[model samples]
Target: MAAKLFSPLRLRGLELKNRIVVSPMCEYSSQDGFANDWHLVHLGSRAVGGAGLIIFEATAVSPEGRITPDDLGIWKDEHIEMLKRITSFIESQGSVAGVQLAHAGRKASTSSPWKGGVKVPEDQGGWQTVAPSALPFSDAYPMPVALDEAGIQKVLDDFRAATKRCLQAGFKVIEIHAAHGYLLHEFFSPLSNQRTDQYGGSFENRIRLLLEVVAAVREIWPTDHPLFVRISATDWTEGGWSIEDSVALANVLKTKDVDLIDASTGGNVPNARIPVGPGYQVEFAARIRQETGIPTGAVGIITDAQQAETILENNQADLIIMAREFLRDPYFPLHAAQELGADVPWPVQYERAKRHK
Candidate 1:
């Protein structure tokens, strides 16, 4: 029997050679959103390592949407050339390239994780952050200006324009970063949105923006390409966005032609207790997949070849999105193929290292 981990999975017109995916991770290495040599090597190595799909980190749709000064940006057309270079290399390695377009909302304008990760002041190039409501992520974070109707339209416009740039950059997949307590998640969770307008105070209202964003991008995005939305299945706190909400949202997203729900949880709240462990979040992906009948991607601490294989074999998720593990070992997929006895090809340059069983 063939190993499921190495099996090809199709989404729209794109066919991934395997289920292993490099989840979008913030590198905080870009300047003015330009993809430098660091990004090329960082993403290209994963392709050489044999990941079927490599999604670039949370790329800000606008300057104000950046989480830190160094966060990647796609707000301008000039950024497309460098990104195109990276995507071309990824495709040459038989790996599909994906980009996660994001807006950090109240979490914007912070220092990099390695540099204290604190809110940067306006004098230091930081600008005012905006959210669905005028609430700060925490007392330590900046208080964001609540987006009025005009501000909301700008957000939608930013996403639409960014989607166009991603297409121009030759990205095969486009994942909307709606999870991890970002702008979209903030609107989805009542804990952050305190508005009484049409965009708040009800389930349909709160999710209005995300639905509109998907619709707008779909209009510009080719029907042959797959569109993905990452969502936090739960806030890990009472009266917050719940798994049931995620299921309901998934059902709605399916109607909008979303290809997959990248299931992740806990980031909308600062102190929501979570049971962190290997595959701790897989159950959410499994549940969302089962309930919504939409293909889901399981992320968070999914290490080891057998562990990823088990999730696929059980029909829990259609994709295994790995983050930190990929950081520790870019060649994880190549090694996994060897361990699982799957006959995956190795880069010719590194074929000498291929193990024989």
Candidate 2:
């Protein structure tokens, strides 16, 4: 039998060439929120490497939405030119390019992890971060201002405006960054969101902002283009967002026109005891898919070809999204095809290396 990993999966009007995806890994190398040669090489290489879909890192929808000093942005039009160039290259290589629109919430305005990962003081160009409530990820992170009604509308507007830019920049997919303790996830997780308003307290209320944001983006995003929402399936903490909540969220999102759920876990708190190992989070993805009937992308420690194939054969998940593994081998799909004895193409320029078994 042919490897399911190399099978085409279609969403709306776009059909992926394979099921192997390059998960978005944040590249804190931008300046003033612009994509440059580094982004082109970082992303374009994966396209060249035969990824079916390559999602750009969490790009801030607004300046204050950035997690670190050097994060990418899409709040303005000037950032489109370079992004367009990169996307053009990616698409030319027969891979779909996607963007993850994000707001960091209380986790914003920090130095890069390599730089000690502390709050970047205002004097150093970091601005105040905002969240569903007034809280910090930890003492090491910034204490955020609680967002009022007006601020919530602005977050929606930022997402709307960013989606327009993504269209101009040639992105075929938009994944709302709601996972890993970001703004949307913050609201969903009770541990971070201590609000009493409609955006907190009840499950319906906490998901209100995300539902509204999706409505806003879907209003502008082409109906044919795929819209993905990444969510932490479980906060792994008591009284926090759980896998059951994720299934409920997925059921609702399907009605709202979300294409897929990028199922990831943890990151809502600094010290949740998560059992870290190979494919530890795949069960969450499988549960969400089975219970909700919505396609899910399984991520987290999925590193090998046979392991990825087994997940698909078992119907555990629809898409296999790998992050650190992609960093280690950008051409993973191409190599996986070789290992599986399935036929796949190589770029003409590198045809000399097209090894046949």
Candidate 3:
């Protein structure tokens, strides 16, 4: 019998060799938003390791959209050359190159994990952050300016421009970053968005911004290429965004030409308690897929080959997206093939070390 984990998945005009997707992770190692040798080696190693799809980190669409000053960006044409080169190498290794376009919103202007992860003041080079509401994520974070009509329009324009740059950078898939307490998430959850404008109040009002952002990007994005939206399925707090809301959102998203929902939960509320464990968020993906009929990617602590296979075999999710696991072992797909007793090609240079199937 063949392993389902190694099976190909089709979306629009792209066919991934396998369901193993490298989740976008922030490298926090760039200056003025340029991809250097670090990005090349980091992403290239995963492609060489046999990942079917490798998504670049939460690349900012604007300077103020960065979670840290060092986050990768796609706001300018100058950033495209190096990114194009990196994507070429990834595709050369038989892996698809993708990027998650993002805006940090109220969550912006913070230090990287190694740098204590606190708010960066303006005097120290931090810029003012913007969000749906003027609320701050926490006392330790910066207070954000409420986006007026013009600011919201700029957000849409930024994503549209970023999509064009993504095309120039040779990305096959584009995943909009709307999760993890970012700008889009701030609009989704009532816990964050508290305005009387057209973008707040009811579920439809709160979700309006994300829908418009998708529409803007879709206009510039090629119809043949796959587009994905990563959303935090639930806020895990009272009166916050719920799984039902996510299902409704997913249903609406499919109509807008979104190909998949990368369903992970929480991050909208800073104090919400989460039951963290292996495959903790897989159920959300399963529910979204079952309820909304949209392809969903299961993420969060899925480290083992069998664990990934189980998710696919059980009809829980269409893709297995891994972050920490890929960081720990870039050759996970190659190793997983061996573990599942499946035959997969290894790079010619590494073929001698590959186990016989």
* Count of residue pairs whose backbone atoms collide, per candidate: 0, 0, 0
lDDT-wise, the better of 1 and 2 is 1
Q: Which candidate do you rate higher for lDDT, 2 or 3?
A: 3
RMSD versus native structure for model 2: 0.8
Clash count (model 2, backbone only): 0
Question: How does each model score on TM-score?
Answer: 0.99, 0.99, 0.99
| CA-lDDT, candidates in order | 0.95, 0.94, 0.96
Q: Give the true-structure RMSD of model 1.
A: 0.8
Q: Which candidate is the best by lDDT?
A: 3
- Write model 2 residue lDDT over 1-357, tens digit each, in one string: 999999999999999999988898889999999988999999999999999999999999999999997999998999999999999999999999999999999999999889888899999888999989888899888889999989999999999999999999999999999999999999998998889878889999999999999999999999999999999999999999999999999999999999999999999899999999999999999999999899999998999899999999999999999999999999999899988888999999989899753
**Root-mean-square deviation of every model:** 0.8, 0.8, 0.9
